[model samples]
Target: MNIGFFNGEFIDINKAVIPIDERGHQFGDGVYEVVKTYHSVPLLLDEHLERFEKSATAIHIRLPYKKAELKSIIVEGIERAGLENAEVYFQVTRGIAPRNHLFPDVPPSFTLTVKPARKIAERNYESGVQTIIVEDDRWAKCHIKSLNLLPNILAKQNAVNSGNFEAIYEKDGFIAEGTSSNVFVVKNAVLYTTPLTSNILPGITREAILQIAKEEGIESKEERFTKDFLMNADEAFISSTSVEVLPIRTVDGQIIGSGNPGEMTKKLHQLFKGLC
Candidate 1:
């Protein structure tokens, strides 16, 4: 049976339980990181852990273990769960305590789960995906990957109800990013993405793509882009741990790049797969 790690101990998911007084349960005071693995090898693990540490530190949530020890735990969890080409989820919560809006007094709780890899829909990968635009109503500290994601959840739900795969968040008519991924626009063979700011999550896959583009001699820039720019771009895509490199075929019912995957998108997808 697959194993899960809860508070530094391995247990079956069904048997793993937490107190109702857990601070994460009452206040959603937690942070998380998702790392992708290919062929039993974790990709950009150090970076993920770094972000994890930063997120924890941002909220004053202390990580129970050091980064190196946590990495070993994640690797062990992956192996124990028999995961190869999969996703590993790590989260830390403020732990159980009396109900309060403030930080908890108890130690933090850590959990890790590994699941079998699941690729995006075949059609999405083969042709492209569609995204709907929604206002960015999330908290201002979007740079920290926190677990309090009701806004993102609602936006994603709205997109799903509209038969779309993702939500591209708009702030003041500008495209911030997909609810849970980084947004990219390609025009005239140049890649444009939002700068790492307080408005969006700094994605690990996004960083890898930038490096890949550099090595492949592709021009890239970090600048603010409006929704109009996204609607008019020759190509667009999103990157995340769950969805590696996904082409955005449509934005708000308007066609993007012939309403199909663009040449640049295909090249990037191919290059991304080559890393595996």
Candidate 2:
């Protein structure tokens, strides 16, 4: 079963509760976080909440609930969902108001939903996924996980239409990140990913992967790389809360490495799943 929460109440998932003037629905005025669960427990929720607060602050929208209350609500949502594995999505919006460009004086609106997690096919994990390099045409502050995702949606749809699974964004001749994931490269046994900057979301799974590499004595670097560097890398993958770690087989239709998932990629993903 799935669950829905709005304002201070939990309602039917299919209920028409939001008003027409809701800011999140009207202007995408919100910041959200998604947490994945395994064995009926939400993973790294504290870290996600920290980021969620940061995103809300960046957008000048103060959250209505404290950290403890937010966590309680999330756990309750998972229990109501009754799924071992779930995706918990929550957002804080600027609240309902009359049609105007200025900020409203109403209280912020908080909405949440818990649904069964989406699983990628085993074949994809084994064979790796296809990707394309697209110019980064989004706003400069991509670090915030805000609700304005028009550019991301467009790029992802374009990738799917072109028979690819993900879209990697290249900003100023260097790899920024994926439309919805963090880009990574393994070259000569060293893991390389973009550093924490204003143009990319600091993914929770990405930080987990880096910590895993450190614990496993695997060499890693947080540095920018070009498309050519990624194309020639021995292994490549994308990371996110939803995807965890997914291998990339090609870029712009060009085969990466031997056109297969590399040993390190598989090893890292195995180690990552251990955390779950």
- Displacement of the residue 6 alpha carbon in candidate 2, Å: 0.3
Model 1, runs deviating above 4 Å: none
Expressed as tens digits, the lDDT of each residue in 122-226 for candidate 2 is 888888999999999999999999999999999999999999999999999999999999988999999999999999999999999999999999999999899
> Number of clashes in every candidate structure?
0, 0
lDDT of 1 by residue, 166-203 (tens): 99998877788898899999999999999999999999
Tell me the whole-model lDDT of each prediction, alpha carbons only: 0.89, 0.95
Per-candidate TM equals: 0.97, 0.99
- How does candidate 1 fare on TM-score? 0.97
Whole-structure CA lDDT of model 1: 0.89
Give model 1 RMSD, 1 decimal.
Answer: 1.1
